[model samples]
Target: MKTITSIQKHKGTTPLTVITAYDALFASLFDQKVDIILVGDSLNMSFNAKPDTLSASMDVMLYHTKAVCAGAKETFIVCDMPFGTYTDEKTAIYNASRVYAETDAHAVKIEGGIARAPIIKALTQNSIAVMGHIGLMPQFVRSEGGYKVRGRTEEDIVTLIEDARAVEKAGAFSVVIEGVVEEAAKRISEAISIPTIGIGAGKYTDGQVLVWSDMLGFFQAFQPKFVKRYLEGATLVQTALDAYIKEVQERSFPQTEYTYQK
Candidate 1:
């Protein structure tokens, strides 16, 4: 597969496919289909490490990015710039550079818009492809009050549109529109020359993305309304675990055929 930078060259002409991946197993599996694999900081919540992504750090992201990159031979890996790691231009560029150097990722994704343009420009100028993220940014969940849909009001719609434009003008190869009104997302996609990847932002986007764990049913504690679970791996895993425990308790496991004869 081509690098994300190469994929960006086809923006507006070809759809870009992406998915979140934290480990080699999933990365290898999705690499065949996805053009980009995002090592998202959502691992903090998904792994039960913390209630929000704010607790996630660059080290944590790099560890998972490395694991994903190990098996992702085809798909371009884009490591996420975790919360707190990119609050300003100086820090954003510094941390973003670190991610590229450490994980050898094809690109890095940061949440925000106009205010983040400088950092995005710096990364891109330094040869690091940057993917912009806007609309209900999870990194600002606490500040924003919670996980809520954006672009619902006239003011929000205008802000979101401007944010999208700012990122594109600032040199983001592509942008992700998440948890925004459908009409707003469609408008942004139409307005920007770069491909717009959406999650709960509607079907008019150039492409779509989802948290792999959420889609695979690995995360059962909570499910976002916009996310559709395609597989129930959680239930299957529980059933298998239960059977294993029962067999062990009843001494039915490791029979002669399953064990080596000494």
Candidate 2:
């Protein structure tokens, strides 16, 4: 029953586990295993077949957040503030407040760093918990010229550290460090009192997160190098579909075994 703030306070001493869930089943499945469940806007790419997170909206996020929160009875749910929902302090607070009121999420995550500090502060001050996201934010995919690693140079590292500090100062309970150098993530984790949840950042992070679809091999087109497939669901689902088709063609389905006896 520990709050996200309590978890952040004891981060390094106790590693946190996080994962993205777009619906009820996955959220229920991962609830026990993960310390946090993010109703991520990555659903646009993972579910709706969009190229990236850009097409996701507040309504889409709210729909999924509600589903995930319904299933995640015990886990702390963090809803993603989708693209274009929070461009400034006033808008950020308004949208974030709506999300808090509508979803069962314990917090809201916004991508950016120093530039978003005011918005973050405003949300936190109004009693909505905030989780900061930095490094390879998907909402910035078009601006960043596609997905890429960050903090390769000294200046970039410095900027990342500053970003982390700013997020902490803005009163975020934790921050996600995505696709950044391991050393940089580690340094940031150490520097901030708030926890650092990493995705493709490395093992030294306070916690790690991955898209549930990617981890379960539901997406067959491509997989990130950092994602490890725990289940080959894509191939399995295809095989099942093929079997059903063959059964129907041969009239093998709706057999006595599957039919209800009078």
Candidate 3:
């Protein structure tokens, strides 16, 4: 099983591959192929059809976490601490502790920076490893208006660096630098000791991650410029469904070859 030590060891050598998986089917498919399987709250949009991750709840997140855990025994699992689950240090610890105890997840990820450092520290101190999220925090997207690349301004880049530093100092095992400028992401990766996983942050980080549905073309509700579709999943599903419907209407399905023989 890949652990914190294994993740840490990949810093300068190999680039890690991380992807999101919320249920058994997807998790099982990603099992040994990926370095990390994040039970992401992106499920709020991908699975539940919610507006954003802010609407996701702890119970919902845990339900998916358990499913992923069941499917992925060896891949490192990191469960997202959904919005509102970590409002304060006490609440954060309680929720983080819940993830640690209730599931086989190896770590919990929470989005933020200096303000979240104390919470991260508390969780790590209590023996729950944490993965910090910086750059465009979906939980706080209301303030940013919408999803836009960060680190465009000099001040923003400085703040991002500080945020990365704060989380590392707080004892986070790794950090996800999302939706930031390429150069800024690279600088932050070089500045930090822990592995930096970039989402839209560019090729400079130690590793990269993407939402499972986005990469597989299963989701197209709101396409981000960062996601690269690896397969035409939605189109394929539609074609298959269309064929089934046409065949069933034409009484062409359940052919003798497909029927069970007694």
Candidate 4:
């Protein structure tokens, strides 16, 4: 399990590995296998079939974080502060403190850059560990008209650097740079002292993260260009199910070895 100090020390030495898990089952599978496990709000889409992550409430996030903590006891866990829960400094502190008190999550992640720096600062000042998220934030999906990849131009890259700096200044142990241009992502990683975890932001970051369902090919609705399917999970599961159904129909499932003679 990597602590805040160890995770930050890994900035330029080695790349970190992060993956999202929504429950205890998968978290247990990934325990001690990855650098960090984030209980991301993206669960709303992949788990509940919601259109976006905005509807994920504090209760929902807390519930999932607790479950993940239970499964990944040896792994460092970060819980996401759901949208609208951290609108102000006071609110941010209250909600972030709840994460520390209510669960074993090591830190809390929040999306934003310079604009949200003060809130992040307040939380950190209160001894809360934070992980900053920049570039294309999913929380702003509807406000931005849709998910947009940032850092196309030189100006955008400069702004990204500023954002990274602000997050570091706000005392975040790390930051997630998502959905950005590759070159820009590299620049941002170089500009920050903390580790930069990339998701769809390319290989130049200090680390990479992916939703478990996306990488495992479980979510069949839509595939993002960044997600590399490691396994045909859905197909494999369906094929196994079909075999089980056939066995049951043919009265071949319950063999002598599987039953008690007495």
Ranking by lDDT: 4, 3, 2, 1
Clashes of 3: 0
Clashes of 1: 0
Which pairs of residues collide in candidate 2? none
- TM-score for each candidate, following the candidate numbering: 0.94, 0.96, 0.98, 0.99
Best by TM-score: 4
198-229 per-residue lDDT for model 3 (tens digits): 99999989999999999999997877988989
Model 2 spans > 4 angstroms off: none
Clashing pairs in 3: none
lDDT of 2 at 219: 82
Question: How well is each residue in 65-98 modelled by candidate 4, as lDDT tens digits?
Answer: 9999999989999999999999999999989999
Global lDDT for candidate 3? Answer: 0.93
| Candidate 2, 40-81: lDDT as tens digits | 888888889888888888988999999998888999889999
Global Cα lDDT for candidate 2: 0.89
Instruction: Pick the winner on lDDT between candidates 2 and 4.
Output: 4
TM match of model 4 to true structure:
0.99
Question: What are the lDDT scores of the predictions, listed in order?
Answer: 0.86, 0.89, 0.93, 0.95
Writing each residue's lDDT as its tens digit, candidate 1 over 125-183 gives 87778889999899989988999999889898888889999999988888999999999
Off by over 4 Å in 4: none
